[model samples]
Target: MIHSHVPVSDLREHIGRTVSVRGWVHTLRLQRAMQFVVVRDGTGLVQVTNRRDGGPLEALIEALTPESAVRITGRVVDAAQVRLGGLELVPETVEVLNPAATPLPIDDRTGPEQRLDWRYLDVRRRPAARLLFAVQTTLEQGMREYAYAQGATEMHTPKLMGTASESGAEVFELGYFGRSAYLAQSPQFFKQMAVAAGIEKVFEIGPVFRAEPSFTSRHATEFTGVDVELAWIDGVEDVMAFEERMLAHAIAKVADLHGEAVAEHFGVRITVPTTPFPRITMAEAQEILRSAGWDPSGTKEDLDPEGERSVSAHMREATGHEFVFITHYPVGLRPFYHMRAADDPGLTLSFDLLWNGLEVTTGAQREHRYDVLLAQAAEKGLRPEPMQDYLNAFRHGCPPHGGLGMGLARVLMVLLGLGSIREATFLFRGPNRLTP
Candidate 1:
């Protein structure tokens, strides 16, 4: 309630009238006869004119500093010569509300690491960060609407687990009162359980943890996850089609709402990708790579980063699309839960959703049959003793289901053309970064 002044963004509606404006000083220009101070109030910016009239106003303007919070009583005036909105304010009084420290630690030229050290200040200085969050909000909202429309129930899956909830290798273990516990790597088991409980469809947006020591720009120890599961799927293609539709809707909404601002700030145009994102089976992808003379280091069951980029590039050249769904990966390259294709037992009904060069999502039609799931787990050298609770869900009558998890930060980074996932994350947590 302390900032009772009218918002700067609405100033155009009150032109030629006296009003009070509150915000931090963005910049100040001093002259012998007149003074100009641009105030930013998060919503917008207004230029305040403090004319020298043989009073204490000159001293007040001289004392003004950038980022200093102030309140100004001014009359809005439109000057054709002025650049910013062709409007400025002529202040009758200026009062310092709060003074910011002089010589900011970060600036426009500051590097990413140092800027992160002072994130709040960095966000205030860069309009791109503001637009990034705005786009993110719209993106999440769109997904929520689409999921609900598809008869999907939203959920808040637990973060704590009795055992490794996923990827047994890279999981965060913590000490409980007298026992040991681990963080939920993904809401995989729960989402599948929801389907087994006859929810039909479910989606969750929450944080997931990974204990890997990867230092890649794309990997984060903790990141927001967008997970979805649907029961009674005809095939893995159903899940892939649902995801493409969801992404297209979200991107279209983001473009409709903030396209102009995004373009102005990030120099990138938002394109709502068309449906049926080009799909190439894993065998075909590897063959293409082999034809191109790509030799991955070691005999890898999965596509390396370079191979992903090359396939994505090929997809773009061949189909003129940014998204490519690499499907039917070998069983060794997928999780034990993925259902192997009935025709070919060696390849699973799984997919990796690649955007521009990075894999943003991995989805599959899960093995809903109890016997099949347990057998697949055993084949992968997994002990079913620890995963009994998860297995129990399928044991008590389950529906045919499948789902996928998409990285929120990764999608945002690729959409905005940001070079790294760190740019999309508000407070990035990686192997080395645990502080603001």
Candidate 2:
């Protein structure tokens, strides 16, 4: 009987045992009398060696190519010659499950644009791609752990909606049963509905669609958003603290499990940020930027890409921190949903979390008063009649709450110093990219 086992790198006490492994050929090195074929099983790579027999082994070697799926029976051997785990598999039998076509469209040495065009082939060689996904899994698990501990309920909101949550940004409009429907830009309204429904703390991890047309490396048409809203919060600080702990836990977990791989592949160490990530008001960040010879063009509300880069560099140099919270945005710049500060009333209680010169999250205290919310919506030139359902939540005893929406791909991109957000996402959908 063929004993089923994973690759040698993932094998622990099962070494030196005969096992049946199935995977695709990653690399093939042939010598005069013997052949070394490296097979990848998604978990890891295992080196398999074959004797110079002019039978199945020879035929397999002759027909082998990258991405050819195969099943083999071999005895795991402890050998120092192999690069992975100091163990190799000596294959006694071989079966070609599927043969690959020659001349791949893209390879390991392909350029970024070409690789993106053929992402499947690119992902096959990119160790960083695998590491990014592993980190994402760890981060999501960490979020769930922290939320569960904090009494937050997990909710899956509808992706299709009748109207936009925030009246500002562009949305992808589609005909849903012959009515004007849009892909949900966020779980904002639904989460607030949960608060009105009396489910206090809530969180959702899901896809958000945007029709943004910029070709910036940080922006994407569709991306995963990590969001959480807490009911009965005093202010935005409570939500900020929750986010900080969540991030710290996720970073620590990822570093512990895949730190070495991250370093080797991405050339950066994952640092679990300390509590209370440097909070600087938007005005202060702008002043800091000016001190660093970056004139933000007198825009106190938002940071242009160059301004973001300069401020991030300054923060890293001065405080040795990659994450920074820029808070108290000008009320004019924020959406109608943002709760204005009680003391100032000119600035909203909103914050953007910047990691390595890129914005990964936008969070704020939401306006919970019915009249105030409606006034803000009208002031922002939005029709309050269309938002009657949403406004009703505030009227029916909605708690004082705040939340943040974080872009998962943007976080991964900045953390790993990837050139584009697309590099960090699997099956990326953008304004230009639609299919495989």
Candidate 3:
């Protein structure tokens, strides 16, 4: 019987011993008297050398193709001339499990769309792609650890809702038992419901759906959202403080774990951001952009992409920080649930966190008082009957709470200096592209 397969990365420990290596054939070099086969596994690659003797093994080696699944019984040896870690495997037998077809659909020269069409094959061939996911995993893990330490409970809210959770124009509605049901745009309402249910601190990392026809590099129809809610918050500042600390913790974890790999593969140096990230009010941001020669063609109260980039650039230059919170947005630009600022009823106690010139988070203190919520909804021209159930959460008794929804892919994109959200996501779902 063939021996159990050993990972290519573990070959160093088994030198001077017979072993079985299993992986896809990365490359094959055939000569008149010798053949060199480089096998690639998830961990690393190993080079195998075989001397030609007109044997059955020679035919199997000749028939092997790149990326073919195979198991090779071999003796591990330390060869000074070998390039791959100075180690080579001398094969005693070769077994081809599955041979890949010739002329792969994608290659190093393939464009983005074609590469995405064969995502699995493309990911297998790129080391940097693998490292991007590793950093993402560590980032999520660090965030979860910090949340748990802060007495936060993890939650999974329903993706289907009877009413459009946010804007009806951006919701995906379908018939459910003859009644229309909508895909949840955010876990905003349910997270508040959890707060009213006495689960004061809660967090959810789940898929969010948006029916936006945006073709920008940062927009996706379906993406992962990192959400958090905390009750008994004094103001929006509490929410911002929690988010900044949590993010710093998670980023530090990524920097600690995969700093070298990220630097090597993506050429990015991960830095753990300092606490109390620079904060500038929305009015201040617009003024800063205007001073920098920003065009005022768009809305005067809100910062467009160019305005956001200008503000981020200014903060980075002034404070040497990568993250800045733009706060106190006008009421017209915020949702009805966002609590209006007491000092200025025309503005909401809300903030947007911008990292590397991209807005990744929007958070605010929610108006928990039932009467104020209804009045705000009416002011926005929204009828209260369809949202009575949500209103009931606040009608009874709910603490003053606030939270933030963060775009997972956007964070990953900025962290690794990725050009687009598609590169950071595992299976990108966009306006025109859906399949793997």
Choose the strongest candidate by lDDT. 3
Worst 10 residues of 1 by lDDT: 1-10
Candidate of highest TM-score: 3
Misplaced by over 4 Å in model 3 are 1-4, 297-300
Collision pairs in model 2: none
By TM-score rank, best first, the candidates go 3, 1, 2
Worst 10 residues of 2 by lDDT: 5-14
Error of 2 at 112 (Å): 2.0
Clashes of 2: 0
**Deviation (Å) of 226 in candidate 1:** 0.5
Q: After superposition on all CA atoms, how large is the RMSD of candidate 3?
A: 1.2
For model 1, the stretches where C-alpha displacement exceeds 4 angstroms are: 1-4
CA-only RMSD, every prediction: 1.9, 2.1, 1.2
Better of 1 and 3 by lDDT: 3
The candidates, ranked best first by lDDT, are 3, 1, 2
TM-score of each: 0.96, 0.94, 0.98
